[model samples]
Structures are given as C-alpha cells and as structure tokens.
Target: MFVHPAALCESDQIGPRTRVWAFAHVLPGAVVGADCNICDHAFVESRVRLGDRVTVKNNVALFNGLTVGDDVFLGPNAVFTNDYNPRASVKKTEDDLLPTVIRDGATIGANATIVCGVTIGENAFIGAGTVVIRDVPPGAMVVGNPARHIGWMCACGRRLDADLACACGTHHGADPTTGGIVADDA
Candidate 1:
C-alpha cells in the first residue's frame, strides 16, 4: 500500500500489506517484505532487502547492499551507508560497495548512523544518535558514539538483569565462542 500518491514505489518486489508513506522512494530492485512500514521520506535503494514486519521510520535512507532481518525497528532518520571511502569523483561499482546486516528483532534508535560492513546481531538495541562502527553482539544494548555495549536486551525488548534474566521471563546468556547472546534454557 502506498500511503501517498506522491510516494514512488518502483519495486515490484514489495510484499503484500507493506506501506510506503509520503515521499518515500523504493527503488525497483529493492525487496520489502510483507507488513513492513516504510515511513515518510524514506529511501530504499536498489538490491536492499527488508524482511517481514520491518519498521523504517521517517527520513531513513537504506542504501544498497544492506539486508534487514525480520521484525527490525529502524528509528527515524536511521542511516545505512554502503561505501567506506566515498569519493564523489571516483565512481564505484556495486562490487566495490560494502554490505551491512541488521539481524532479526534488532532496534536501531533514531538518527543512528550505521557504517557499512557491520553486522548488528539479533535483538540488539542501539541507542539514539549512536554511530555504529563495528559488529554488535546479539541481545546487546549499546549507547553513545561508536556504540559500546552497556548491557544486554531480551527479545521482548526489555533490559536483562545482571543474572541474565529479563522481566519478560526470558533468559539470555553470552555465547563464549561466538560472543553472541543465546537463549539459556538451562
């Protein structure tokens, strides 16, 4: 569904029930999944893949070579870049671009600038205005410039206690080998 007649949704790959809001421009090769919300003035570049139920807020610019997993929350004006050294005079091909991956259930707060080639792990929460320069571990809550991990988050979006238990009744612990968060059934 295109919310505004002015919105240019050129993508035939947009799934059913997705909403592209005012002034949003979804390029032809972009793939937006079902029930996704692309808010006003957002730009989805070609070859970008947004999984189901992703929330891209106003003025967000999702460049090419980025893949957002299911249920991701991209706060207003969140930026995803593709080039590490973007020179206006140097024309770069798609092969020269870097890719960024936002894992399932991750929340990138408003105005965050995510540098390309980084993987934001599942259920990670990035604070507003933070600039992410590296990979974020799963279930980690990071704030401040360059985004340091302050704590862990539950899949339910609640902060986990020191005991690694969330009020939502989910238990998560660090995976020593991978450095990612994992559900602890035991």
Candidate 2:
C-alpha cells in the first residue's frame, strides 16, 4: 500500500512494501528500493537512492549524491551532508555534490552526522551523537565528536566483550545459546 498525502512522490521507482508516511517528502528524482520504511518528517531529496530493506527513522534528511545501500538502518535524526564547503554567493551543481555512501548493513546511530565525501564501510557502526569526519573502515565501531575506531561491534549491534569479537562474532548468552550478528543493526 503506497500512501502519500500532502507529500511529493514524483519518482516512479519506489518499490513495494515501502511506506512513505505522512509529512515525509520524497522528491521526483529519488530512487527508493524495496521494503523500505520511510518515517515521518523525513526528507529525501532528488538524486538520493535508498537500497533494499533500508529503515529510515523519523526526522532524518538524506540529501543529494548520497547512496544508502541494502539493509542500512538510519536511526532517528541521522543526517548526511553532501558538501564540504559552501558560500552563499556560490551555487553548487550535481558535480559539486560530494559522494557519500553508507555501505550495506551499516547502522548509523541516532543523531550521527556524516560529512560529505566519505564512505562508511560495510557493516560499520556509528554511535549516537557522533560527528563522523572521515572514512570508517568495514566492521569498525566509532564514537565521539570526530568519530574514532574505539573497538569492534557484533553484527547484532552489541558492543563486543573482551573476546575481541567485533564485526560479526558469535556471543554466548546466559541461556548458553549462541547468538551472532547476521547483518548490521541486528
């Protein structure tokens, strides 16, 4: 069921099982893939591409020249900026929009800010309140103002214990049952 009331959905490429909730705007040129959940008050501008099974939370803004790949979990208020520098007198084009790619199965924590021209590697985890200023390596866990590689994270989104298992290691729970992170964001 596609529901777009008072929001613009000029793009014909939005796939099925995807719901564009009220007050969320998807522009004409955006291409959204299957099984995506677009929450309220989120703005997806032109030239943005959301891959399969992407879950976008509320109040998030995905600007142009940004590619969010499959199984990406964009937490509430996480933002992607496409420009390194800006002047009011200068106008930017599609070429001026620096490339930003959130790789497959990555979990962008709430309120994280990814700056322009950086590639967040696959299955990486960005902590809440982080301001990412550089390229995050695959399966790395980063946190802080300018995010740094603090440790590794399981695919289940749990901060790994002393076993040093980060980026998809199996952990034994209290029931003696083994659990693993099949993908980013649990």
Clash count for each candidate, listed in order shown: 0, 1
Please give each candidate's TM-score: 0.97, 0.86
lDDT of each: 0.92, 0.82
Model 2 scores what on Cα lDDT?
0.82
Stretches of candidate 2 exceeding 4 Å from the true structure: 166-186
Q: Write the per-residue lDDT of candidate 2 for residues 1-186, one digit (tens) a residue.
A: 475685567678899889888788888889999999998888998899999999999999999999999999999999889989988899988898798999888999999999989888777899998999998876678999999888656656677765645445564222112122233223
How far out, in Å, is residue 91 in model 2? 0.4
lDDT of 1 by residue, 35-55 (tens): 999999999998999999999
Residue pairs in steric clash, candidate 2? 153-167
The worst-scoring run of ten residues by lDDT in candidate 2 lies at 172-181
TM-score for candidate 1, residues paired by index? 0.97
